[model samples]
Target: MSLSIVDNGRELFVVKLIERGEKIDEHVQREIMNHRSLKHPNIVRFNELRNLERGVDILVATPGRLVDMIERARVSLRMIKYLALDEADRMLDMGFEPQIRRFVEQMEMPPPGARQTMLFSATFPTEIQRLASDFMSNYIFLAVGRVGSSTDLIVQKVEFVQDMDKRNYLMDLLHTQCDNGAHGKCALTLVFVETKRGADALERWLSMNGFPATAIHGDKVQMVS
Candidate 1:
């Protein structure tokens, strides 16, 4: 569910899923577990899932679980031609910068010429931009328009509710939207909650009320949304 499904699964975009308000939930837990089990040349693998006192830590490696796979002689990165970070802003926001820095630092003492580094984000802040600049070489700011702009093709809706009733409101809305031909034949609904704990609570409540739902948040990882 964290990955967006498009064109009948022809395109799979598992961008960084952010749960701004609540804590961890079953959905996030399952995704992390599933990702750990997946083995592929293009997939990112998480090996050691650590829950420290400060936060959760995912020892994720692009292409494979680097530390263990290298030791086990499973795969090699000799043919890797490019390095990319999807949901980069979310990664930094979730506190994976140190791990990322360490990974980049271990890139074999740097080869001749510049190793192309690219960053794409839905929202960019001045401070984050500065940090990204520090990590890249000869990067150019290539934004086309406003920072948090929306698309014309996308219809938007905004609703106001008291903080105490937000959860209930969201549940009611989801129920109504999904009920009997309202959402038009099994359309997936994406709900964005504020915190990891809130996400956990909401998913539980929805499930208890017989609504199929899931949530993902920072508390489930070594980062924060």
Candidate 2:
């Protein structure tokens, strides 16, 4: 969908809204890497409001920051050709509905039919449906797969191990998987830790045990190539 918008070769402007947090930084960094790799002239990388005046083909932002920019006259929604709300339900759940409504309804942006609006959510309740009715015109509802259900390719497993035994347990699991060839060469395994120190410790342990691992957290500087 984003490719189609970029390929059109028009003076495109897109606004992507998502929840904000430390975790969001990793996701944004990954996206920035992908965007840089594309090397498309039409795609402009925007991070701050000061850069918005130079021109942006796509703007990925949080509702609060976007609203602040709009109020500061740094961003004008009048030319926005595409507005996408990713994790729409999550944003609403996080009490961002007022900000969303302010930009979509009270701003200078084009009305529903005049501009393309895409709302993506894992689950849509009554409030979400009401938001759709209020913000969209003749929108088509398409369900790609069952909600709240994992795909067959994903195998869920649970193992109860004490904190003291976690490291050894993980080492054993990885060794077993390696022996079974479950994870081929260069396959990645992601493990989540509660804190930055824990992540660093785990990464060091994995590396010491002949496994290459990198830890990313808020404290670490992320470089996108």
lDDT tens per residue, model 1, 43-132: 223332222112222222332234334345443333333344556677677766665554455533232133444566767877568756
User: What residue pairs clash in candidate 2, if any at all?
Assistant: none
Clashes of 1: 14
Candidate 1 TM-score, true structure as reference: 0.40
Question: How many residue pairs collide in each prediction?
Answer: 14, 0
Ten contiguous residues with the weakest lDDT in model 2: 7-16
- Model 2 vs. true fold: TM: 0.61
Give one digit per residue, the lDDT tens place, for model 2 in 1-225.
Answer: 334434322232223343233344334444544554435433323354455676665566677877887888877788777777777888888888998899899988789888777888888788888888898998888887886567899988898999999999988878777776755544467999998999999999999989999999867886779
Model 2 segments beyond 4 Å from truth?
Answer: 6-51, 54-57, 151-165, 168-190, 195-200, 210-225
Q: Using lDDT as the measure, which candidate wins?
A: 2
